[model samples]
Target: MADLLHSVYVADKGLIFKVSGYSQNLHLVVDLVTREMRAASGRVDRHMFEAVREVRARSYHNVLLKPHKLSQDVRMNVLIEPYISVRDKVSLIQNITLEELQDFTDRFLDKLYLQILMQGNIAWTDAIKISENVLKNIKWEGLPEAESPVIKVHQLPLGDRKLRVMSLNPASTNSIVTNYYQGEVATVNDTATLEVLMMLMEEPVFDVLRTKEQLGYSVFNLVRYTFGVNGFTITVNTQRDKFTVSHVDRRVESFLKKFSKDMNRLSDKGLAAVKQSLIQLKHTTDYELKEEANRNWREITSCEYKFQRLLIEAEAIDKVKMSDIRKWVADHFAVGNKSRFRKLSIQVVGHLPNSADNATQGESGVQDHSLQLLHAGQPSTNIQENQEEFITSIDDFKKSLPLVNTPRVELAQC
Candidate 1:
């Protein structure tokens, strides 16, 4: 029932460790959690793998303990690390027959060879061959057969002795899908997003809150994403101004519609460029063998392997029209009130209101409180901060500056 598992793992039943096995050529870091375990980095080997193996083997729940550092005996010091209880040592027990242990260890060492090939300091074509071999050798029971293009490759080509490749398949709607299967939502928060933000600020949230009700500038209109979860997320920060509870709802609804309509006007070239850039990113990073291994394992256990076909599908993406993108945005990305969303949090940075019509909402029609807060908070503020603040009239400001701080050259008006 845990989300991620950060405990240690052993293929040969703790006899062989897969850490530092790669030396400096590769590094594999694993942070196992409940229900899910994450192992990443380059390749690792026996000695370093032993260290990681020990840390995980000696953990109490999630806290790792170094077995060697426990006590002086090295023998007696085995299980005395901090936060470790003797009862927690029960997981270390192994009941396999020596034959079973030997076979498991053989499998571990065999896979370690493949690990070098897949995660080794090697070439892409060579690594691909190694990956195919790794898959062939590390067959666990009930694992579905891997088809052609069994891997979705993410590669980074550097013109050096060490070439790199990174790939993940996202087949599951959950675990290892991005690594083992295909599907992700790439949002465009570029100039277009900024333009949208500016337009949405049309009825500046401040007016809606202070003029009608009151709120702070904690007002936000974002096109965000849930960390590794698929989908686009929009968040509205409502601290700057306090709005009538109903007005907040209505404004959010209105803003979404306008955003969608604008998206409908996006140039085809722009959309295509963004999509292409995302797709091209598939080739930017190199793959480490451990990632490939865990990703495959996760897919076999938690996702589907067919996700390897993502890149091709993505490359063959349909030429999207402005209307199509707009509809897609509205369907998947818009921020209207829905079951997936809620008023996440409403934080008022300045003085907050205790009343339901929150004291922060201010007198029904109070002048801009920010301006008021400004004057009230600092009576001796600087004049440069003002947009139209000047001792002289516009004409006088232009002429009089000659005496104050005139430019040396005959400055041309921009």
Candidate 2:
């Protein structure tokens, strides 16, 4: 009796097929996977209904209500993979029948570019045999490597940018403000510098925004790597009852100002200490095989394939001087530096008292009435008409910008 755990997932680029269990079950798993991949049958309606409900449920999730995911969705769909819908349409899902689903699978399986990442106790010959067995039954024309799509992000035009969306959950009072400072496409050195910068600012950011100013209980910074574009985000989770989204946004700006000064005043010794701290972090041992495998998977999926990324980054971190940090700040994060500075501020406004005059009182008021204006191409109260700073329509704004193709990393770099 051969039994194995298996999963199929859709990613930004392609579908991933995974299976794990005893080595003895490898052939059995492959046979099962190939059979499933060739076609889909039975209970299609039930699966579609579940998927629709899943999407609906996700819309109301607390995490989705925050600016982190909201901003990410815009960045991915509008600025990155413009062709892909950030959210699947429930209407489309409802209309998709068993025949359509099967047809889609047939079309999908017709062309292929399979990337296998085999690990664990499996023998090399067994891995190769398993891969061969999986592919033998599936009729596919090998896709040219050049024809494979490379994920690209639209280069944001210089100046301040903003996208303000009313939270979908009207009863929720949790508003979020995220200030993202876009960096370059990034080299190994650039990646190292930004990581170090985040490490240094992480604690201070939380302290200044949440602890000192009492903006909100949750405040932190993140190094965002969308496809291959590198950037950083400073986020504050505040309630509408305590503070307005704009107030929190301003406080984040203030924190950045103070942080810039702090960075400049940072002594050479202090900078070295920060670098050393980051180096130590990179050197930290992977506690499990999964940890190591996941790290490799990230590089593989990102098309960077830098298995020695930690070691390379550690070296780069040591080389990053105070001047390099200052240059990075001026180029990306500085308020006055508008030429190369790309900043996008995304605000998710939650239910508030008098945030807008038309806002209804009580839990019933949780409706996203402003979304009507969004669909109508009318600027909401938060955005002014003809304001270049505010992104009235994500599609239009993205269309105005040029997409930059991220260069794939060669194995030589590894």
Candidate 3:
């Protein structure tokens, strides 16, 4: 809601729309505008016009002067959308003096910049000035004619590619890797595209690279669930010892080059297997009850992706052709992975596999003395799936354990 309000707020002036009739919602809406909240929504009130003008002169707008690329402008795709009539609005519950409005607007813009735009790559100070200038100078021209996005990957030759995942969306994390991977063109957005892309990698990446070859402990193929709560990420966790981050990176590149699916689509047998695997993973064997609770918690906490895992039938993905997968990867996974954080952080105590040399203690700098191993190539962590799994607490362990009744309330949050 806050994001929508911000987009609307930054789009131009204050929003103005009339409902068939609104009763108690008017005051509530006005309160939000006055606060200058992000993506906030409210009813249009008499004072909102003045507020918009005030914000224009005061708060920074995130107007993109050259937004053609983001909106698929190259393909000549233009979006003309209708205004939605909102029933809710912000209310000015606190006594905000008019004298404070201008300063508040400036503060509001500052908060917005800090909250969203500063990706740690850029300094806050620099972003502030840039945002201010961009907002102030924007011509506010009408929406541009949408066109096809630049097909950067489509131009790649067979030899030039490394690894690729199909269409990546900025809204997702895997899209980030998909782009950073080989030259595969990624066609990503919403659910359909993301699902197809994920299905293609789901087994091959896991069985071949992670399980068989032992690439990274965390290296398991993943299908993204973007429908409910937009999601995308496929992590490969390994210690630093086995492969320099660079070596794994290169291997993935090589793997992508050879793993082409231009001819054969997912076979019915493949689809059925994938479907069965998915079903197996979905139902928590009564023993995996904590898993169920954890899922429920996520669903309750975030409105997105709660029912999504249950909703999508994985069998639907079997129809995706190998060509589609290749093209998608080629497009989205071709570039831009330097953006992620690699703090080289080490928590002194975490889940180190029992196989680790426990006798060894952290030296002045463990980066050297401590071995770093990738999950795939390294020996198993000596973990037993049958053993008591780690949950938030023993209570959670019972929640996940196969049983008829909930665990006694002896233990609390851990």
Question: Can you write out model 1's per-residue Cα lDDT over 113-194, one digit (the tens) per residue?
Answer: 2222233465677555544543444442332233211211111111101000111111101100000010132222222332
Q: Lowest-scoring 10 consecutive residues by lDDT in candidate 2?
A: 369-378
- Cα RMSD (Å) per model? 25.3, 4.2, 21.9
Top model number, TM-score: 2
Give one digit per residue, the lDDT tens place, for model 3 in 123-150. 6676565545444432233332242111
Q: Which regions in candidate 3 have their CA more than 4 angstroms from the true location?
A: 1-203, 206-218, 223-242, 262-269, 279-294, 305-309, 312-327, 335-414
Better of 1 and 2 by lDDT: 2
Cα lDDT, all candidates = 0.30, 0.73, 0.33
TM-score (C-alpha, index-matched) for candidate 2: 0.86
List the candidates' TM-scores in order: 0.31, 0.86, 0.31
397 in model 1: Cα distance from truth in Å?
Answer: 65
**What would you estimate as the lDDT of candidate 3?**
0.33
